[model samples]
Target chain A: MAELTYRDAVIRGIAQEMTRDPDVVFIGEDIGKAGGVFKATVGLYDQFGPVRVRDTPISEQAILGAAMGAAMTGLKPIAEIMFSDFIAVCFDYIANEFPKSRYMSNGQVKCPLVVRTGNGGGARFGAQHSQSVENWCMMIPGLKVVAPSSPRDVIGLMAAAVRDPDPVIFFEHKSLYATKGEVPDGEIVDTLGSAKIVRPGKDATILALALMVPRALAAAEKLKSEHGIDCEVIDVRSLVPLDTKTILGSLARTHRLFTVEENPRLCGWGAELVSIAADEAFYDLDGPPVRITTPHIPLPAADLLEDIALPSVERIAERVQRSLQS
Target chain B: MAKLEDRAPAPKGSLNDDIGEEKRLALYRTQVVIREAEQRAYDLFLQNLVKGTSHLSLGQEAVAAGFAGAMRPGDLSFCTYRGHAHTLARGVPIVQVLGELMGRDIGLMRGKGGSMHLTSVEHGVMGSYAIIGAHLPIACGAAWRAQYKGAKDVSVCFFGDGTTNIGAFHEALNFAAVWKLPVVFVCENNLYMEYTPISDVTAVKHPAADRAASYGLPRIVIDGNDADVVYRAAIEAYDKARAGGGPSLIECMTYRYSGHSRADPAKYRPEGELERWKERDPIKLYRERLRAFGVGEDAILRIDAEVKREVDEATEQCKAAAPPALDILTTDVYADGGFAWRN
Candidate 1:
């Protein structure tokens, strides 16, 4: 096993796949020798040269659309869109073009493209860069959306997304780049749409993703120690093929649920979880589901304001307490 | 008396040994077939035999026929919605084309992609997009694949003058140049972008050639109505791109005989413009040139009969063909049986 940061794990996954498969190439703005803005692609330029890991002009539509073409033509291209905020610029390529090709062509083309972008706030990047738009992507039919919280899961999920036969929107949280974890040596593969039970407890189920997963874990720790409540934390690794089985299984045991996210509370990913639980496992619930998420406001830049606007461990713990009591 | 774009496209150049009498005749036949087929489709639409919208390539058949003939097999192309001529030039079966237009089960794309989005991956057509300039980057990506995989094949993208203004056109061109991808950007500058004249919208003297200096590419403004001219330009560009010389943009100054869509009568055209262009119609001009080159009237008449018969049989077959099965709507969302992620 090796201890690496979340960003390093992403590079490892890409480099390993590139080395193994000659057809695999990575393209983005500043991804070549500059090693990417976050340096997630460091050392890959010297390793693969310009053809495989190419730098591109500041064109999101071209990058994503080019990747779609490359994927259809037998190249497994991992295209980085810099930040998830810029996905709006190339929205049609993802929301319209990427998904429609396979369905519209009647199974003639396969779009095996992976789009990687940094998401979530708490870094003071302001409203444009800090937004988490997983809900926007998860709605697409032919595309898969995945957000991994840990180094181990990131490596596994990145590799898996590359190997996937369809389009994958891989969301990497900017705040969790330096977080270290032990990624097992040799091949470590995880299923794309399955959720993992990071913490197993019978008292309550906390469903979270990416930046919110750590906060949920911390809240679970507080609930266990201070409030004498056992909370199961479920990291939603893949949002599209959501691991409803795991979430529902946990709900069956705990009877109480807390959905946490950094996206806007209204029409958020948490709402999807609530709807799923309510529709499938309504009788199993003890009380109404509690949602801990950022309010529908543009993320402010100041540290104090950003902290207040975002989801936190304390708010989640309080929500967990409230959910249990109610 | 003349009107807009009154100047004529250059006459056919001296023939090279590569283009034999047989190939010349074949090219002429393809252009005629395209013109006839497009007219038939329009006629079908009038009769309510064909559903949905169509963007016909009535006067611009030479450009489609010329380049499609020039490209080697397995080389892909991405085109705009006015791609019926391009599809016919790529040699997609007439039955399939008409069946698709008629929304039959046996159509190209299995009737999912109608006149606007006809697809034939086997014949190396990626698809024609309904959105302008959308397929440029896609063609560049395919060219990148050809170069990356050590293949000799190239990719061609056909769009209008209006597409040059879209962000995708600039982005695709820059990417193709930066990567030295083997792609050819063919602009069918048919005088107008829908109803708006090129003079009102475009600022440059030559839309396609003007961007070449920035991208460090070899570009040309050509006589698109001249089949021989387009063929020569397309052949050279294809060879250069395949030889790792990077992309080239060819702007063809032609005119669309019909309106932008089926309903458009093109009343926006200036006085005598339509009449002047009709005097130099591609099919008529090509027929005279073929006779000058010693192809007999009997042979020409036989070719016309063959094309007319092909269109007739295709129309009849399409009229009798079945609609898609009801269960097909439930299928093809995913390759496997997994459901779409509904919110």
Candidate 2:
């Protein structure tokens, strides 16, 4: 076993997949000679040469469009958009073309493409560079959205996305890149569309994703040690093909639920989770569901405002407490 | 108008007696096949036998026939919504296309993709998209794959004058030029993008062909009505792309005889536009050109009769087909079984 940061695990996962399959390649800005802006693709261009680790022009549309074409023709492409916000420029290629290709062709074609983007607010990079848009992608039907909160989950989920026959949006929380964790040395494959229970408890459940997972864990520990509120934490790894079964099962046992997301409340991923739980496990709910999400406004540039804009461990705990009271 | 003797060397290869009469006749026959198929489709639509709107390629048969003929079996093709001629030229069975228009289960897309979404992966026709300039990026993607894999195959992206103004068109062209990917952008400039003429919408002097020079890619403007001219240009473009000479854009200056979709009657067209385009009708020009090249009258009649019969047979097969079952609506959304069924 090796101790790897979430970013390092992603790089290793892509490198392994590229070495295993010649069809697998990486494309992004600064990924070639510069090793990516975040250095996640360091030393790949030299090892794989220019063909596999392409240094594309600054156009996000070009990077994504090339990946889509490559995926359609018979290559497993992992394209990295420097930041999640840059995806806005290529949304047409993603929402209109990639997802609709297979269905439009009646299963005659499959886009085995992976779009890896870094998101989440915490870094001093301000609003544009640090925003979570996983909810935007989750709204699309043909896409599979995966958000891994740990090094192990990132590596495993990335490998799965590379092998998946459909297009997948693999979101990496930029704030969680340096966070180290135990990652298996050998090949690890995790199932998409399934949630994993991080900590088990019967008093209440904390459903979270990506960077929010760590906050939820912190909140869970605080509730246990300080307030004596036994909390169950479930990491929702995949947002689009959400593992509702596991979430509902946890809710049934815990009888109370609170969701934490870095994105805003209105039309956010957390709202979807609440609605799903209401429809699937409403009878099991002991109280109305609560959500700890960023306010419905653009991420603030100021440090204090940024802190206020993001959901905190304290906020998650407060929501969990509120859920228990209801 | 200039006489035949005054014309230039016809681009590259000469259309002389050295080229066999049979080959020229075969090319004409292909054009006739597309024209007859589209005419029959229009007739069916008028009679309400086919449901949904269709953007007819009535005046642009040569562009599809010529380009598809130049492509190898493995070469990829991405076309716009006005793509019936392109699909038929790429060898999708006429019956399946007709069935799709009729909304039958046996349609090309199993009745999921209607008139605008005809796809036949078997023939390397990736699919046709209704979005104006969307397919250009996708075509670039396919071409990148071909080049990366060290394959000789090339991708042909066909769009219209309307699409050239969109952001995707410029983005795709720049990427294709920078990477030197093996792609050919075939812009079927039918003068108008639906109701708006190219002159009205574009600020550039020559539209797509002129824009190619700005991107440093080779451009060729051809009389789209002349099948032989269109065929020669396609051969040159395809050869350049396959030889790893990067990308080329061919502007087939053609016209549409129908409205943009099924609903409009094309009443907004200019007074003399239809008459001017009719003078350059591709089917008639090709038929006349074939006759001038010594294709006998009897052979031309035989080709016409054969194509008409084929279209009639396809229409009959389409009418006999059934609509897709209600359950089929949910399938094919995702490769893996993950979508929720609300019903």
Each candidate's interface RMSD = 2.2, 2.7
- For residues B1-343, what per-residue lDDT tens digits would candidate 2 score against the true structure? 1112233433333346533566577677778878888788889988998887888888888888888877889999998888888998888888888888888888898887888988899998888988778888788889998898889998999998888898888888998998899999988888888777778989885689889887997556777777666676777888888898999888877888888777868898979989988997887877677666666689889988988898899888888887888787767888864355121
| Candidate lDDT (C-alpha), each | 0.87, 0.84
* Residue A134 of model 1, lDDT score: 86
Q: Which DockQ-derived CAPRI band holds candidate 1?
A: medium
Report the Cα lDDT for residue A278, model 1. 95
lDDT of 1 by residue, A18-106 (tens): 98899999999999989999989999999999889999999888898889889989999999989899999999888878877876676
lDDT for model 2 = 0.84
Which has the greatest lDDT? 1
True contacts kept of 1: 0.50
Off by over 4 Å in 2: B1-19, B337-343
Interface DockQ of candidate 2: 0.60
User: Using Cα atoms with residue i matched to residue i, what is each candidate's TM-score against the true structure?
Assistant: 0.96, 0.96
Candidate 1 lDDT score at position B294: 67
